[model samples]
Target chain A: MKFVGVTSCPTGIAHTYMAAESLEQAAKDAGHEMIVETQGSAGSDPIPQSVIDAADAVVFAHDLPVKDAARFAGKPTIDVGVKRAISDGPGLIAQAAAAAADFKANPAKAAAAAAAAPTGGLATKVDSSASLGTQVRQWLMTGVSYMIPFVAAGGILIALGFMLATFALGKDGPVLITAYDINLPKDVAHSIMDSFNPLSLTWWAALLFRVGVAAFGFLVPALSGFIAYAIADRPGLVPGFVGGAIASTTGAGFLGGLVTGILAGLVARWISRWKVAKGVRGIMPVVVTPLLSTLIVGGLFIVVLGRPIKALMDALTNGLNGLGGGSLVILGLILGAMMGFDLGGPVNKVAYTFATTGLATVGLATDAVQYKIMAAVMAAGMVAPLALALATQLRPKLFTEPEQENGKAAWLLGASFISEGAIPFAASDPARIIPASLVGSSITGALCMAFGATSPAPHGGIWVSLLFGNIFGFLIALIVGVVVMAAIVIALKSRDHSLAAANA
Target chain B: MSLISESQVILDLDYPDRHQATRALAETLVADGRCTDLDLFLSDVRKREEQMATGLPGGIGIPHARSGGITTPSLVFGRSRNGIDWGAEDGPATLIFLIAAPDGGGDAHLAILAKLARKLMRKDFRQSLSDAATAAEVVEIVEREVVNA
Candidate 1:
């Protein structure tokens, strides 16, 4: 007998590969030849089509729906949880082998056997008991993942645009204070030297700046559209995008984007649950759901929600600007806690977008308040991974071999300002790791703000310290944060090990 | 050459500890022409053990390396009837698979190790190995599951 298997999990880290190992062992023990594929966070090594075609049966041990499931349409298969593949691998292989034999003996039995296999075979059942907070977080993460490319591409282009614009100015010119200030002075711009030459360095720089601004314009709608798609699939998209456009038009910013996205998603979801006839249901997804949801969400945003949200947004901007030293530190602390709370998750995205939006509108190079927020956000973001790398080095015995290897990479990732480097540790032991990250990051954010540090650039972590108004203060904040985070994480891990030993 | 041979199989070996077990396996690999130098292989294995404990669930220890001392890819299977400490949090290992490969073997070594590691995940495979009546039956099981199958 021959079989093929795929193992996948939600986080796509440890569980996926662990299950693959188990499945391979079980097939060999059952005296059946097999090839196993792992679909993990690092991506997949897809099995060859020839192997799939030759296989008698297939096994799918997954938490999320397997990608490209249609490839195994007619095959006799078994699907189970990833955990089952790890603990009961032999038994699962035996079951698959038996099914394979039955199909060979009688091909007609394939469909019936597949139907009788289990409930989670193709479309898995949802756990109704899962908390609301957990569900919201998952949906928010889906939106944020889709929104990141826009941020990276747009923000980097805008930074490059400004850098080039500054270079075009003669040494006698004063530093370009703002993006808008990049337009050549009236006399030069009207001169025949500038008019006859459309591809001047200043013109090219302005073009780059405008294109980057256009891409940034899509950020809110993308976030809103995807958030709704996560909730109600295709039907939610139009309403979510329209609602988000209204939010941006009304000056509600990122906070308004969040409200409209969740509202649009819930509304679309509620509409999807309606008990319509089969004929109507077919057309509902195509026409009815989108039209009605868009009308409702768009109308609500424009009429009822727009002014109130705008007022709230205005109050928020004023509050941030008016904050005294103590209150500014507190605000920084809050933003920092949010950034590390989930490590590149929805919470982190919220803090990031908050800072980036401020950079976009508040004249980052000139506005001290705006640049200080950016400094605090980047410093807090860098702390999680840097602290984790430090913790692994301080107590290597506390971590697994893979984690220690990850630590070596985290050093560069953290320095370059990538918080996602710490995600593996957080995913492994969320209860302990998250709290430690939060406590340390909050302290870092508070200290950075208190030091009155500022940054012109939106990204680049510790390497961008030269851009900071107070480089010494920025370094002090980062070092203090790294030390605190490392200390907390090490302490937590030690306690966990002792408790495990005691239990044993 | 094949990764494993009948001569390298150690059925019901009585090793007092993990160090002795590792040393006994290294000697067999050298004798079978699978390893170039006994001392180098032993040191490489010891260095790997220090990096991480190889003891897995199901009473198995897979001490593996891709070292300069290896002449060819090889697997040395040892059945320790009394069990020896493999640094597993669960308990000692009754089955030890000493995996070695040439330093330049690259993905080939990982491919073979992955194949063997997957099979060791099965309780039935471990149970059959433990209850094998003779060294020949043990070799048959390893050949079918770890090498050919």
Candidate 2:
């Protein structure tokens, strides 16, 4: 018998490959041949078409919904939890072989419905009774993941615009578009009001800056709208977006966006649950739900939530601006610790979201303090993975072959500022690894803040180091952090080695 | 000449805890000429233990290492009369498999680990090891289940 399989898990790290290995071994044990595809966080290895075409059956061992699942239709299938595949692979293979024979015998009814290419949104919803906090975290993560590309694109472009503008037109250069004057120094001045004109350097810089700012304008709305969509799905989008726009207009910022998004979702969900007539239910999602939810959320924001939220935003901005030497460094230390503590988990997301919101707060305003926070967060996040990679390289005998392999990947991931690359190491040895990351990151955060390292871009790690004000100081902080983390992890691990010697 | 021999197996062993059991296993490897330095070999094993708890379900503990101290790929099996804590949340581990492999060996070390891992998943393999009355009997079961697995 021949079988093809796909295995995936939500985290997509250890379990995916473990299941694949288990299944392949089990198939071989059952006197069959198998080819398995692992869909993991590191990505996947594509299976060949010939192998899939010749397979007697397909097995999907996954926790999350499989991507491109429609391709496996019409085949005799056995879909089970990843744990089942790992624990009882031979049993699953036996069942699949039997199911394949059944499919061959009865091809008409089973093949007809199963063979049709399913339209994209066919996901089997996992109906676990998740806690409130878990559900909210999932929704928030969904919004953050969606908003990252926008943040990266807008932030980098804006930084590039400023750099180009400064180079092309010095401090004494003429303004392309004044508050009221239409006629500009460049020939492309007329295009400002008319949409776009890329004739002159000054005009191009202005165009890039303006376009970047326009994309950034979607940041808050996208965050809030998606948060609501995650909770209540499509019907919550309109109200959530409108509420977010209002929050931005009212100077309420990210906090207000979060509140409005959740409010919109809850309101939409409540409305959907109402026992309406069949005809009314048809239009409820399109008409009644959107209309009522938008009106209520919008009105509440304007009449009630707007003033207090604005006041809170003002206080937060003032508090951040007022922080000086010690307080500022302390803030940096806390943010750094949070980022390093969880890698890319909820705690890390909080610090990142805080830094991004801080950037948004100073919309087009060049604030050194705001940039310092962003710089600290990025540097701290970058240190953990890089330090671990260095440790693995330094002491090859101390780590497993698999760990040494992970270290090579961590080098690029750390440089790209992806702290999550350190997740596999941390998961294996949380006791030592996490504390090492936390201490190193805290030091980086403190140093970056103390030295007043300012970054225009919120992310892009070492790649965008040139865009920062105190680039030398940033590099020093990062280097010092890596040294501290690598030394600490090596020391801790070696101490365990010494303890074992003593026991022996 | 299999990975596990009668001299490597300890039946009805009296060990207070994980530390003692680990030490005893390391000493056995050194005494059997499977390992060069007990200190270095035990150090690597303990480091691996600290990294991961090494406790498996069904009252099993597998503390494994690939180190420069190892002279040959070896399996040290110890069946405790009273179970010792190997960091399993449920209870202590009665059956312990200490796998020692050379640091610079070919894929032979990984192959041993893979075979051991697959056999450890089977209830009957674990039960057979537990039901064995003597050290030689324990070695025989491991030689059949894991050495040729």
Candidate 3:
């Protein structure tokens, strides 16, 4: 017997190919001939006309809308979920063949009803409950990808700024001062310094510099929204950007941006369900929704969110500045603990947000705060993924080949302050891995703070931060944190057979 | 071996679900005396599908089954005017390739699959096949491609 089949899913990632492989294997085993076509990201690549003409039966496994069902005007098709297609495709194909014969024998009733129904429209609604965890993981991945470049660009620039200022004060050769003058300004010459200062210099240049920084700042949210949009489709971007901007301007920082990005993506999806014309549909995305949403959200930030948050950020920065002797150690411990507690979850985000806010409002604005908490938070976050990767590499038996591949990427990502690098591990074994990550990250954070490491950059991982100042202490803190986390992971993973078994 | 048996092939003008596709394919087989019991063939294929999915990364689906209902391996191709959800990465599938190999064929079946996988990877070859309107043309293209490879 000869049969033809089609398999597809909404996102078109994993299940599509698995079903095709299964059905082909089954057909070969059962002493039959079969050909399968996958409708996925790459697009259709099969003999459509010939397949329709020669096939005795057809099977369709899909979740999203498919095209061209009308060509098989008289052919029987078995429509099932993509998951079902992968899990039970051959059976569906066989069922389709039998139903086709029965219809041919008694053509009138079945043909009439089937003809009346629209093609590719019959699909079971997706169960959101089953997909929530996957959605969260995807959201985190998008956020991490977006955050990396921001940390790199902002961190390196700020470091350069600091080094240049230090050189101008005669701490180093005038090489950095010359570079800063070319890239930005020179502060050594009183004439040059006076010419550029906000009060003494032309206000235009200062305004341009501030605007440039503000525009550069906008990139963090914009890119975050764009990545989330790509993952979740058109609707996800609007809210992602709005949320990111709100997070940024309100001192909620990157953590807030991550939350907003996810919120925006999910909200856009819900809104897309409101049926509208295809012509107007394009407008719903490119124009109306984004414009209105950004305004409403931005307004909310200014009117309600920003003012109250301003006081808290001020008080925190002030309190940190006031700490002395043993109290500084306690502060470091608290900040470090908060940084690692969530590892990019809500608590991690709060600490990160506070740090960025402190950079802008306290560090750059005034010398009111001597210690930088944001740097510690970022440093800690970076340590968790690197530590996890190292742990996985050390114990090859603890992870699958795929996970090991992810570990390499995680190490690179973590070194660059890409907090999302730990996602795959967290996803695979949340119970054991997350706690271990938190411990490692917290230790790094606290140690870095206690050792008096200060990062002028609002964001960065170890490498860029190390270039600024206090390289020795930063390296020590990072290595210690990584070792602490690795030990914890090794201990926890060894105790749990399920983790090893699952990965293996 | 011929890519497809001419007598066992049927051009379908109706679009039913998987049940209908199966029935149409089986009826064609039964008419050619390939199998005595269509229900047994249907059940076997359905049961086989319970293990894994047949959806490919590209926008294609290959649904097939193994059963005593067939005397020899056969290939069936179908096209949907309005495509159906076939669990493909891009979404729905418009073209279908069904393969039914004799039980315990082993290496022979694997050889055919290897050839098919290689041929399908070629964009122009797959495009030409999708454009082919007749079963003989599809068989001709497949045979030519396979022989050339």
Candidate 4:
């Protein structure tokens, strides 16, 4: 058998390379050909795609997520920590060989696992060795990750709807138009179905607004359902969605959705793992698990948890409504710092989710605190990438070849509000880049809050400026952040005495 | 220019803890003139160790650093009669390799480390190190297995 693998440890110096050697030696003794990639601080010499394609089995011994793991999707895999490979190399190799044989014996089972596995580009290793907090973050991130596109679509559509309605009715458009059931029959109009006029701005505006509302309706359920999916795969989906829908109906908002997601996922997972007869086992996931879990979770939410959660949501809403002057600036500072901290990591996602989830309650009032938060987050997010790009442009010699190239692409990415465009620059020199980012973003966040820039759209950055109120304030905040961050980065890099080498 | 030499090998390196053992190994590199500043290199090694313990499951600890204090790519071999706790889950490490690489210019020592790293995992390679009678013999083994690999 041919085996291909990757080995990485936290420090990425000693254990990573040793694990690769040990695995290689063990495979050789078993008369199997093996290729191992060692991902160390010095960097990795990645195994060829052809070698991975030819391999019957794979061994991933890493404390970190295997970079580009989806490449080996359908292969028989043995995943463990680097220490395990070093200690029991022979055992892991034997397991890999066994897994390969198992695949050949039952190809159908392997296919089923592959089909159900979340091996998309968002693949993250929920390392059993990681702390409970880390594990929970990974799970929550999976749900938030899937929930993003929904928010983007719904938020933008709604913003456009509001925009068109305002344009059509001048100022009284939304209030008057919303009172009438756009779907209901009234004389000869969209209510008349076949009499729909494409050129009628008022009619089109009302239609877009209603469709946007329909999309917003799915927001909470999707968040809860996907969170549950992260925990227990497909079996958790039914209860998760049920729990989310109940939360939405109860007016419990995102807090309720979060609770229901975890509850449903846990209950479903527990039920699926119960010891049962062979016949019972076959019906377990399909009939028993979802049924029992949904009953348990749904009852708890309605009778026990729903009221307290709704009250909490009310208190939160009131608190945000009362937030003024100083408190708002502090909140913006914290959220902005979090956004820049990890560059689209869990911290950034948490900040993003905080802003987007609040969008559910803001309802078309662009002056609401939720709208201001959305504005602040988007402004802060745009700063890092644009700053990195500006820094690279200002001093191209300070950055590496790859970073300079990334900077060129960052102009468009930053304009589009993709914070991840700065990740490459941060990854190479975190100590210098991260602090500069935090400082810049915090200032940007504070200034945006102070300026009272309100964003109607949850996303689209500068492109969705039509949905933003106080457009000049937003532009000023964004510009100030970019310049400050770029200046700080340059100052920090220039401080280092060994500036000649460039690579170092 | 060699990674490990006679001056860098200590047959009976006695120390209270891994910190002292690391300091002792780093002192040898300083004496060899491979490391320019003992404090800087030692601090760098400690910083790297703090990120993650450098202990391997077998009775081996490799403490390393890429520091401005290092003038050359150097390796020091230390054998402790009484093992020092290197924070491995299994047990204490008797064999310690302190690797110091230059801060800039190139990564010649990292290449040496990559080779030494692989060889250290083999049982025969480890057995040979423990069986070596003198510092010169141990240096010869490292040169053959790692430097010449």
Candidate 5:
């Protein structure tokens, strides 16, 4: 068994090191693996999150309060004074091993304890009595349920715009009309608006698509805002919305939105608990709380966290770029998995960018590797929504009425190359949906690459059939991916899993 | 300069109480030009001792502090052959190590003292310290074992 521990004393010098050394020595004598983080006068060397996450049990021998004590909340823990660790290191190790075994033996009770463990910031709600995982699910559900209307309104309008564009123009209809919907200069757009033909379907298509684009902008911020609202009531909304907007501007997407929502909520909840004077108390909630919480959460997200996330994204893009020279099949698989991993989140955008950039390099060579990558990317992107739709079609009982409705609409979205159609489902139940989608999408990507399918067009799924080089291979990959992904999703959600417990 | 020298170590460090022994050991720090003000540093050590007695089982007492008057980190060693009651539950301590570090320069020397603290847990290290005849030998054992810098 593996163990992780922290040791600290009042002075944080001699006894702290002694206790840590004793525990390590005792664990070695007992032939067990143990890692101890010494919080001594010489400052603590913090345990990385990965190490803490992997540990079987945690032992905190501290006279001082453990720093970030909440990180170890879900693990089995042994709490004792510092001297006890120094005196009876073997006894503590034995107890920790037994506790780990006992926890593994009774996971339901352990999970219940974890749920009741009292999260760091969230102390007051009736939902605190529920397990930790459930509390998170509730928060996410709140955000998703609130954001679904936007998803539907925005997605349908965009699809309708594409349909109308197809009706108004020829084969190059969507490609041409999308120009009006994107990157249009402010002056050029104003000039076009000055000569607007309100009755023209072409103009209507551009307007609808543009409005849908604007509506889509709100999806991330709304999700973030409502999540914060769920956590800290109304006070959380400002920071959450601001953070989500920043996340969007920074291209951090839905993942960043999720992080900002939780952070803002936690900060808002924390600020609400401050003890202020009677005069200041009146302004505390309305003025002071919002102002302080927004400043803190916004500052943290942009200054501290934003850099690491941006760096990580850049690293991932560079890694993918390096992998271009490696096996094309593997690249396809990797990109496919990323697309289904987060839907329209950062990872999906990276994969999409990789393929599109390859298209830009393709220039006139239809037989270039870029075309094959583009074909594989499109095929892989279609996997999530199609699979989710298929799952709802196969087992409507597993999903809610709203989800079933989303599923029915997802068919057209999935067919028209809208990967974000699955965002509602992914947001609602990521644990099941993401894994299932990743597996199926990667397999589809590999299959498409293997078949040497090519797409000259950057966008579009089945709608722009004329541009596809090897349509048969693309269809086969899409069909296989859809079936595999749907089957996995159905298999996953059909069970009494923790994620969909509320929905069920 | 070394953290400890011959002038800093007193093999027969017997005294009626720990205060006299600590004062005697501190005088060595003052003589070595490591302490600027003796009274202030002793008061700080006394305050630390009042908080918790610096006693250990198996006959060892380590009194340590970060003092404003401490110009550089220094170690003052003493061995009480007859044993001095440093408040250990088991018995009086025969070996005592006084560790003084400069304020805010803790990382440089506390790391060395921390090693000394852990090494004192070993019977061989303690035996090596007790068996050494001269102050130079005691310094040799400590320098080699825990405080190399």
Candidate 6:
């Protein structure tokens, strides 16, 4: 007997192919000819019509609705769920074959039975637990995609803004500045200062400028939440956004916003799977989910999470405002160590959040500790990918061709404070890479602290230099950290002659 | 009709390398009238393996040459019970089906390979094949599982 099958799933990743494999194997074992077409993210690749026409039976195994159902019109078709397709596809195929044989023997009875059978389609039967890595990757991918434009726009605009400011200041004749001064006439200086004054601009222009800045400030969290929503579906957006906003306002920082974004997205997704009413399905996704999620999440943040976060930020600010000599260096070391420990994982995010909040609260008040910590964290995070890339290049034999390819991309990403660029390395050998990155980052952080590095901007890499502060020390710290990491990797790899021999 | 003697050199190979494994198997089949040229058949099989890793999900690898590589349609069962590094993701491969067929023999070879893939996925069938020591025993199992289709 000949059998034809269609396999599909919603995500179109693992289950679809697994089911196809199971069914094909079953058919072969039963001494039956079979062909299976897979419908997935790559789209459908159906078995030829001729094959289907010659087949004794057809099986449709899918979670999503199968396309071109009409083609199987007179054929004995069994519609099963994706879970069944993966778990019991072979059994179903055997059953279909037996049924087909029975039908062939008693055509009139089989036709009558087929007419009486329900055609509402089968329900999915797989366990619904989302894995941790899958969840993390989903949220991270969304955040990364959304964060791209904001990072690009903000970095470019700020760079250009600094250039303009410098040019304007230069034209006005240099003042006798205390550090890194350029000579200029008094009248020119006055004109330069006046041009920079907010009041000098037209009211509308000033208002627009302020609005743009405000929007720029909020863009990161907003986009982060939206991206999380996209990953988790409609219900995730509201809570994600509200939680992000609260995180930002309460000084929980970008890390907190990220956490809230993921939490909200997951909650939204969970609610959607509650098997609610069909009549209210549309409303549940668009209206009820978002509204209820936002209220609950926003209220929680404001009442429970927000107050403690704000108090912590206030304490940190007060300490920086009243700090002595060695405190700045110590803070820098801690921040740098944290940033390097996990690259872009939770530890790194916590360090980043700390720096951003520190800068926001204390940088405006002539506090140097906040600047020191920010500089160190940013420097440490930037070093990880660059270090890994350099290590791969130095010891190419120790790594796979794919790893080498990823190394090239990592170089650019590392230089830009994109810690995620090191993910491929971590994924391939988390045990070795994570520890190595942490050590390198900590070294960089320590150097930054020792040198009293300062960066007004909370972000890192070359872009951090644009903010009003000393950049030379930050650059030195980053370079030193990356170099240290490279040396360690090379030394470790050199000792593994067996690995080299295998590659050869 | 059997094109080659069931006792031909197709089954008894214990080579270290992939090229050697193919050549040894091909030479056996050729000596038994399964094919005309061992070198040509081995080369064709090697070329196909180069195009993609033949490693299946389970510990099986089906390395087959196109019909042009053979003088006649034949199934060669080669077992490396000691385990050979077949570049499989799941490590070494224990079972191999070296299929050779006459030029333009339609999709019979593909159908056979597909059948073998399905049969190997079954725990009982795989275990039975693993336990089968003699070439005749293996042939009987394949004919029972696949030929009935």
Tell me the native contact fraction for each prediction: 0.15, 0.00, 0.00, 0.44, 0.38, 0.06
Candidate with the larger lDDT of 3 and 4: 4
lDDT (Cα, tens digit) per residue for candidate 6, span A1-504: 999888866434334555777888778888998888776533345454456777888888887666555556567778888657655666888788987887789878877877676754421111233466655654564564455455445433433333343344442211211111122255444333233345432222323323333444564476447645655655676787778877877677655676677667777777777788789887987788887777777787777877766676567667766766676666666777787776776667657756654543411422257767767877888988999889888888777776787688788889878887777677656767777777788878888878777665555467546653456777778888898888877676666666767888
Which candidate would rank higher by lDDT, 1 or 2? Answer: 2
TM-score on alpha carbons, each prediction: 0.58, 0.64, 0.48, 0.67, 0.45, 0.51
RMSD of each: 18.3, 14.2, 17.5, 10.7, 17.3, 19.2
**Model 3: runs farther than 4 Å from truth?**
A1-148, A170-216, A219-306, A309-350, A362-371, A388-414, A419-432, A458-460, A465-469, A492-504, B1-149
Pairs clashing within candidate 4: none
Give stretches of model 1 more than 4 Å off: A1-24, A27-60, A63-129, A167-201, A272-283, A362-365, A429-432, A462-468, A488-504, B1-149
- lDDT tens digits, residues A1-504, model 3? 677777765433234555566666666666667777766433445433444667766777776554445545666667777666555555775676677677778778767767775663322122232266655654565455455455446545544544444534444322223222213334444233344564522233233334335444765486447545744565666666776777666776554555556556655665666688888888887876676556654565567665655566556666866777567656556666776666676566656656654554422421223425656766787877788789878997887665777787788889878776776677667788877877777777777766767675656576565443465666777789889988988888887867657889
lDDT of 4: 0.84
Best by TM-score: 4
Worst 10 contiguous positions by lDDT, candidate 1 chain B: B104-113
The collision pairs in model 2 are none
Candidate-wise lDDT, in order: 0.76, 0.78, 0.60, 0.84, 0.78, 0.64
Please give the DockQ score of every candidate, comma-separated. Answer: 0.08, 0.03, 0.02, 0.30, 0.28, 0.05
- Model 1: lDDT of residue B50: 81
The top-ranked prediction according to DockQ is: 4
Off by over 4 Å in 4: A1-125, A176-196, A497-504, B1-136, B139-149
Which whole-number lDDT from 0 to 100 does residue A222 have in model 6? 66
Worst 10 residues of 3 chain B by lDDT: B7-16
Q: Evaluate residue A158 in candidate 6 and report its C-alpha lDDT on the 0 to 100 scale.
A: 34
TM-score of chain B of each: 0.90, 0.92, 0.78, 0.94, 0.93, 0.81
Model 1 chain A scores worst on lDDT over the 10 consecutive residues at A120-129
Give the number of the best model, judged by lDDT.
Answer: 4
> How would you encode candidate 2's per-residue C-alpha lDDT over A1-504 as one tens digit per residue?
899999976434344665787798899998999988776544454554445767889999987677556556668888888767876788999998988888788878657746553433422221223468778887777667667777888877766666666667774222322121223446443545554456667666666666666777778788888887777778878888999899889989888888888898888878878999887989998899999999999899989998999999899888988899999999999998998899988899889988877776533344457888999999999999999899999997777675787788788889989998788788778899999999999999999898888887877998987778788888888889889999999999999989988999
Docking class of 5: acceptable
Ranked by TM-score, top first: 4, 2, 1, 6, 3, 5
